[model samples]
Target: MSKTKESIFDYQLFKRLFEYIKPYKGVFMGLIVLVVLLAIFSSATPYITKDAIDDSITNKDTKNFLFYMVLMLGVLVLQTVFQLLFIYYAAWLGQNLVMDVRVKLFDHLLKFKMKYYDNSSVGVLITRAVTDMERIADIFGQGLFMIVRDLLTMAVVFAVMVYINVKLSLIVFAMLPILLYATRVFQKYMKKAFEEVRTEVSNLNSFVQERLTGMKILQLFTRETVEYEKFKTINERHKKGWLKTVWYNSIFFPIADLASSVTIGLVAWYGGLNVVFDGTNVSQGDLVAFIMFVPMLFRPLRQIADKFNTLQMGMVAATRVFKVLDTTSQIDDHGLIEADGFKGEIKFNNVYFNYVEDEDVLKGISFNVNVGETVAIVGATGAGKSTIINLLNRFYEIKGGTISIDGVDIKEVTLASLRTQIAVVLQDVFLFADTIMSNITLNHPEISEEQVYQAAKDIGIHDFIMSLPNGYHYNVKERGAMLSSGQRQLISFLRAYVTNPSILVLDEATSSVDSYSEQLIQNATDKITKGRTSIVIAHRLATVKKADNIIVMDAGEIVEQGTHNELLSKENGYYKNLYEVQFLQEEAV
Candidate 1:
């Protein structure tokens, strides 16, 4: 069955969401008390009418009429007071609850294994943390306590109607079965409609976020018209989902209003005959009060059906939010061992990995790098060169064999311990729209301003950064778009350098830089790689020739391993061919 046809409210999902409320139990329970009080005072107003008509108006007693008027006004004042308190406290609790849930969600996402991110969309995760969070807040803000107040008011109205006159109450209640059936049908199908709405909302978020993030590519390929058409189709489906709810509302509410009107007609017919013709227990006072009570009772019943939709939509949001919270894809940090000051010795023993099952991106690859060694890996595209660096950092778990750091299996060391010692500078560097200093230090208080300036000077970009408007404080804007490709590479190198990692990874991205930046990049590379266990995934002959060792990868396996002259000594070695091709490309540049 489709998600819409599935069980409307997952009670299990609700119970899990409600667990977040326990931290503020005092405030939550206080709101419930306020709702109950609000219902009591509001329900009392109808019964006030009966006593005023019977004891004062019917008897023509002036003193009794005066007292009932005062009493009626007092009930209204109390109802208004309790209602104000109910609205304020419920909203306060709702905002607090969602705040706590959003924080927990972001924290959970931070520790998730890279494998989880590999398969998940950035837009869907954003929708879960943002849009879905607000909807869950509605569960408390406008949904639960309001439903409680309405139902309690209805219950009191029902009891008062019966107490005033049973036969007349029975006459009114005969119309109830029809109204109740309509409400049941409305809740069931409205939930299904909302389910569709929520699904479409997620799809729209994913599509829009992806398109906007890659807007440059979309424009470059001139696919704007084609993408716009696809968006309209998705958006139209979303429109239909919402209009389906509108269609249900147009049908169900009128049925509810008809039911209420029909009950009032029945009460007037039955109670009038008894009072006028029979002159029995149903008095003029009771007849007058029933008219007031009929609307009071039916109003909440209709509202409860409407509020039931609010509850349905909240549960749908909760289900999606909790699905992410329930995911077990977080990187296992069970190891207790901490990485301390040590030599940088790394090994991959018969390592095998794949992004998908049995696809084998790394096929039993084995290699070793000793302390303070500089190794370069060279390969054509899809040769699993980057996969080795990923496994070393434990970003992904290998399917077979063991990866060790300093002779200890990496699985036995804590993730922070293992990761803090390694720094990687990728081809496509990512920076927040912040100052250069903040991007380099990432706002770490331990790495003060002096340390940052020193690192920048060490890497020879201090002068370039000083030339910008605010120097180190200059805003690079989104993804360092304000700077050139070479500048971004230098900032990444400075970022990786300040950490003083035991192992440095330089994914040589010198393929697209001007001559001036190329010389600066080469100088920065020399400084950062100088006394560290460095691994360079080479795309340039300068980096490959300087390496103490070069490992050639081809189609998920290491094809050859040796120094530059040694690999060149082989007549048909993989590294020799790769180096020659890369050299020709640079010569053309």
Candidate 2:
């Protein structure tokens, strides 16, 4: 099923976004003050020019003219200085606000259950974290300042024009309503266009990210051309979306420019007639001042319209970001029991689970693993073996029944405490782009170099690691791409061992390794599982032959269960067939 898209301009979303900036109110208010002062200084400049032209230059008044000119220059310099100060402060506040929101969003995402990630794409989430936050920052930094400054400039210009010549000012101001109405209409259209553009951009980002991350798979399957064609199609759609936004903006600007021109032309014709015929209150200086103020008046209105478009885009991005932040994880740590430690007696009593409603994955599954026991689960893909492990780890909560550890229901235990007691080594091992030493001692942050070496030695990868140029300090590239598959799995094994977990989960941990590395990992597994409850989900039947008990699962039900020899005696049992097939394969090898 597809997820629903949400609107960004929802009032609740804006209210929530506003809350992020609330903490930096002092900086925000100071920026506003600076913007207002800058606008006033900018608007007053034209009057200074008019004064020098009409009174000083025209009338040949040299005494105070120089003083006035110097004063005007100082005001211009002051405005420039304050403008820089405000821009800096606005950028700082905006960046800090983005950081706060991004951190909160990331924290909330981490708390989400595995199901959320299963349903959402990694690319979309990453776009929200990066591109979306940048959009919001742009709005907060420049878009917001533009709005405030423009409005202030417009107001000051209107007030000055009326004070100079009310009759001519009224004629010029007659077009204000028309300009405002046009802006309102354009803003509405631009907002919708921007929202569409943001959505398409998100889709484009997701497509590119997915393709790049899966480039190896695409190349392996010889689907490079096919994927390229698909990417081209998405890119074309993004272009179309951007073009639509540009089309609207293109129309908006021209119409705005025309309106402003008409307003200025009408003001000039009427004011000129009054100066020529009636010799009214309007002066040549007043006319020049009005013309200068005309652009100032329409310039801000035009800017407001343009900035509105940007603000809309930012709102769209914010909506996407807030969607993730607002999501309430179904599995919460609330009302959980806290414990100092855990004893590894696990029970799954009549447990039922489903990733989606009405589609049961695990049907009334029940099992028990005693303390310090090795239990092997053998099954084909999608037979619910991994689902059981996931449920045990509380990655996905069971819809029905109870999973308990040492007589305490896992749901009643704190998630951190419950997870702290368990360590997992999966087939697809993930190593961060860091040194091998860091990967092993991930759970124990303060682990010493000696402990890291001991853990690596236990996993039987110490000699190979030491042979590397930098030994334990050798950089593991993204996803451990620099290392061989077997080597990466060995590091994961060492990591799991270092945790000293009460329960160790090995889900095809050695499946990717070669025979030699598999044997080494298997030997390390023996030491790691000593005195701990262990669950091994192995595809290679030989890997779990030494398990204390083996549970054979088929279609989400345990069909057979016994020791290796006992299961082999049942000729028609699933385990026997699996064991025979693996044995034949090994013999062939």
Candidate 3:
């Protein structure tokens, strides 16, 4: 499905961005004031030099020369102080703004529904959170100050030049149109080039992360050479994108330099002519001062042009970052109802769902599980089994019909309250890089250490955890890479168990564990599901043999459903065929 192309710098988006930095507005304003003061003092130096030349050097007034020189030196010192102050405050504001953005973006991401992750790339999102924020910081810290300081300096210099000689000022100012036109052209192309560079960099980062995470699989499959070649292609694309940016910048800078030089050369020629023709009215001192201010004008002009590049790049990054922030959490809980307790009864009535429009994954499916019933859903890989569970959890909204818990529509209960009542243990377990104890208590952080220990023991991983070098304090690597699959599963089981939820959903939760660990998980599952509605989606037929009800699904519809014996008695159904295949395989073993 095609996504909408939304501009990132819409007024509302920047208003929200400004809100994040509003607390630091004092420092930001201080930086602006410092920049303006520095620009004023810096721009005044040429006038001092002019007075020194006309009154001291040309007319041979030694006292006035030394006095003006001393004053100019003092002005230089003051400018430097203000410059330093601006840098300090600008850096402080930039760092604080970036931190606030990162924290808010991360916090918002955690609340996002699973469907968001399913649609977005991890690399793209990471770039927005990390790299994009840094770009914005650079814009705020250096880019913003440069823009303000240069514009103010340019304005002060132009006014002083016009006062010194309006005729010469108008001659010099004629180049403004040309400079602006060139800048406009450069800005247009540079914006496009920088956008491509940003996209390429995001792609390269994504490639690196994906390959690094799957390094083991790549090596085992002997696809290292193939992957290396793929990476080379990505790297080359990134290089080309960067080269395009360089090409534009290279052309832009030299042209800008030539334009500035021409402006200065024209001012010098015109001002010198006026000095010669106008004689006493325009002295050598005034011409020299005009020459000094000539470079100042073009310097700020050049800087303003350069700042546009930074601004363009920052705008591109901001666009991407704001795109994420702009996406409304479609599954947000709008219900005001808060429940102190939950009954495990769940019913899906005439429910329909689709990841894409006009393509139903679950078609008008209806099922009801009474409180404390252990129901097993069996299906082929894409038979909408997991989709049903996802819908029950409201991971994706249903197009038609209602899902309820104890006769209350799931939408009527706040998401936190609804989810707090359900615990899900999936086949693909993810454990954070923390102590075993922390992983177990992830869902119930207020649970005591004793409660954690009891939950771990109930899941039969407590002894194994204790046998480790650091017991419950042992650190797991990313996604629990430090532990065996069975150990990770055990931790996940404990995590679900400690939640003390009203409903339990296990999706091949024990498929990775050994027989012994499986037995332990099964025992824990029995305890946890004692008075809760439980939905088990199992690949292994043997795992659900004792389910109170077995649902066999095929092609997005339930083909047959009954207890294990009842389904086994039907010899021609999909469930019976699956059962016979497993039964014969076990016999051969």
Give the per-residue lDDT digits (tens) of candidate 3, residues 1-589.
1122233123554566678788988887787788779778876888998888888998898988999989999999998888888887777787898898788788888888788898888888889999999887877777767888898888889888888878778877887788778777777777777888899989988888888988999999999999999989989989998898788778877877787788778867876776778665567777888778877888787777677678667777877887787787768688888866777888988888888789888778788888889999987788988888788788888889899989999898998888888889888889998888788787455888898888777766678789887998888978898888877877788888887888899886655668887777777677776767899996665557868888888867778888888988986978889777764475364
lDDT of 1 by residue, 284-306 (tens): 88998899988888888899888
Q: What is the lDDT of residue 19 in candidate 2?
A: 90
Task: Provide the TM-score for each candidate, comma-separated.
Answer: 0.97, 0.95, 0.91
State residue 106's C-alpha deviation in candidate 1, in Å: 1.5
In candidate 2, the residue pairs with backbone N, CA or C atoms under 3 Å apart (3 or more residues apart, or in different chains) clash, namely: 337-412
Top-lDDT structure, candidate number: 1
Instruction: Write the candidate numbers in order of decreasing TM-score.
Output: 1, 2, 3
lDDT of 2 by residue, 329-411 (tens): 75767645876667789898998989989989888888889999999998777889999888988999789999999999888
- Give the residue spans of candidate 1 off by over 4 A: 2-8
